[model samples]
Target: MSSSIDSQTAAQLQEILVGADDAVEFLSGLAGMAAAAVSEAAGDTIECAITLKLHRRPVTAAGSSARAIELDHVEQALGDGPCIMALREMSTVLVVDVSLDARWPLYMQKLLDVNIHSTLGVPLEISGGAGAALNFFATRPDAFSPDVYEKAEAFAAAASNTLQLSVRLRTVQGRADDLEAALESRTAINLACGVIMAQNRCSQEEAMAILTKVSGNRNRKLRDVAKELIEQLSGSPVRTHFDT
Candidate 1:
């Protein structure tokens, strides 16, 4: 590993990252690229972790590979760790001297257990809220240099912009899902209301009241009651009702 990357290489990397189209793909690429660049520049091996938050919580590690899943498990099991702190504080936190830092005793112990000595964490900015964190780890003490910090901060800024775009994408996707679900529910409820109107010769309000009463009596969701009504109207098997 070399202790420096030529300015040309750094410029090329920046250009590629800026020109990338997909936010998630860009962030993923930047993580690996930045880690490699820094490791080469520092003449040491490094490990990095990027955690993205969704719906105000860190998503489960279901879709990740073993190493990532293990990291997520560590954070969950430890109850307090660098990732949690980074997410909470919304700033970079460097544990250059983890052995001397006494702020998080339990977390530091877990880090030591895992043989993680030095760490640097930077928050991934999310518009409208606190976002995610990208953390880098080194086995050796005092692995980060002043130049490393400067370049790492610049890379982190680019990564943060991509992460913010991801947040927006997720929000839009969530809204789309919500709208689709609402549409389906409204369609089912309307069908059920129409069945009631025809069968009981009642007005829309009366049908809704009847469904509400049935829902309360059965301790069931309104959607369930409405679905049952629609199923009956469509000649499906009707569920038997009983007194609570």
Candidate 2:
């Protein structure tokens, strides 16, 4: 039986590796793939959550909808859970048969209250830094046997790759957004410069200086000042230059 299980786990790990390439439509979808793998392996309802501290704000990604949301709230409000422990320890923590396990009295009780009888969660980390936890929860007491743990570790490895990719993708997306914002600001400042040049009959550089002077004096943003100028030209005091 053990040998068969190992063979099954190996096959599943291979499938995960194949399915998890670089073609992720969204971060949530990657997490869903993980939860689905665990469910198929454990033959029960499984939930997985990935939590990371990005830019000093805690961001959570979950594969199962309800369990993920519940866990998110629990971590935010209580600040203590398996996910936190996983990130803190940077190691896998499996609590098989939670009803019988006495570790973490408060959280364990909370799990029982939610009808989660067994759990096997492993911390998902990136390069020794705190990343996220690949958490699996089930409704059966003996859901996580040794075989399950071995299979889960293999699954976690695949999920960890997805997690790392998601992180890099997000970083790239964020930088792209910043670059777009900077370009927009530059365009707005230039538009305002043109408006000032036309209104004051000054050179382009002189108009920019006026804008700077006015912005500094009023402690307002250059774009805001430019927006106000355009609105003034339009003869609409209530008109806003920017959407915000």
Candidate 3:
């Protein structure tokens, strides 16, 4: 039997997806939608999830149900599963029957304990960042036949494109946040240096030298040292040369 989504559901899914503002949430929700579509076609109960590894951190992006999310968590704890492997190998892994799959005995046993017997993982390639994968779960063995796989593969392709955009968006946002942090660090360091200059009657260069020395000696980041100085001087009388 061919598993495929109806036209109406596809339209609604598109509308729902376009509203998400972040890549993580969007992909997560997309995972749920894809699972629903495939399950509907298969006419069986199925669960779905999305996992993405970005910046070397792996997160469960979304799940078709709470159980789906929980399943992914189990795999993460064990550091083994078809989904995690799929991302690492950059390929698809299908455990047609989880209960008997020898590849990940522990991981398979965990799934079986939860009454989940089938799983499929498909990796997604996002340019300029760590990759991701879509994971699905089912109550029965061999839940994802070739027809179901084909439908999911197509959905995964579309999801990959969206995930790429989301990754890029986050990358840009991350850079902006870093820049802002650097600016704040500079401000903090300068404020601390100015305070020291007044209190010790020293030149700006001397104040900076003292700060750098303290930072190295204490094995603390320069910003951390600067922050400590600010805290200590928070309520003290203003000691800048211009203070009267």
Candidate 4:
């Protein structure tokens, strides 16, 4: 297959990235699209699953269907399979016939039990110490011919940049959420401290010390204790501008 992505598939991948609400949704869409692409190329039904790893640990998995998801999970649970191997080796791993592939005995048995006889695992290039792969499953032996393999590899290559963008967006969103939560917690704690100072006729530092003591005695997080105190005093839940 050519290294360059065809225009239509590239547009579809771009659409998946732009329209997805989060990383999970984006991965699911990507899996479905990958399945469709390979199926179209091979003229057979193929299921796809995507596995993502960060720091050499599995971060998430998505599938084109429920069965695809289950198969991927089985591989993860067993800790060995073509997909896992592909991610680890950063190369394509193909099992032309699951029954005959003795490399992953347990995984082959599991796939045979599910009536899936062939599989292809193609790694996606991603930066930031992140790794990803597209896993394709078929119901017949040697379903992934050379042409099909080439097509799948091409699709994975084309989708790599989009996957990287999705991951970066998710990381940014997570950091923003953490920062927002910290700000809200600080606001609640300050308000709670003010209430304590007024009620006890104490200094701000004294109020903070009292609050900390109460938090430790209750064995609860400082933020939780602060929020509860404010809620009890106001007879309503605390609401920050970030709420809703």
Best by lDDT: 4
* 105-188 per-residue lDDT for model 3 (tens digits): 888888989999899998888798678888889899998989888767767776667666666767888997787777778878
Off by over 4 Å in 1: 1-34, 51-89, 97-117, 235-244
The TM-scores of all predictions, comma-separated, are 0.65, 0.71, 0.67, 0.80
TM-score: which candidate is best?
Answer: 4
Q: Cα RMSD (Å) per model?
A: 8.3, 6.7, 6.4, 3.2
Which is the better candidate, 1 or 2, if ranked by lDDT?
2
Report the lDDT tens digits of candidate 2 across residue range 1-244.
Answer: 2566545544554454446554333445545656776677677767766666555445565455677657655664566666666667777777777778877777788888888887766766564243666667787887777766766776666556655655676578789778767766776678789888888899999999999999999999987787787667766532324444
Candidate 1 is scored at a TM of: 0.65
Rank list by TM-score? 4, 2, 3, 1
For candidate 3, the TM-score is 0.67
Task: Note the residue pairs that clash in candidate 4.
Answer: none
Mark the regions of model 2 whose C-alpha exceeds 4 Å error after superposition: 1-28, 54-60, 63-65, 127-130, 194-205, 227-244
Give per-residue CA lDDT, model 4, range 1-244, as digits (tens).
Answer: 5434566778899899999887788889999999999999899999999998876776447999999999999998888799999999999999999988889899999999999999999999998788999989999999999999989988997899787777787788889989888888998899999999999999999999999999999999999999999988889876668656
Superior candidate under TM-score, 1 versus 3: 3
Quote the lDDT for 162 in model 1.
54
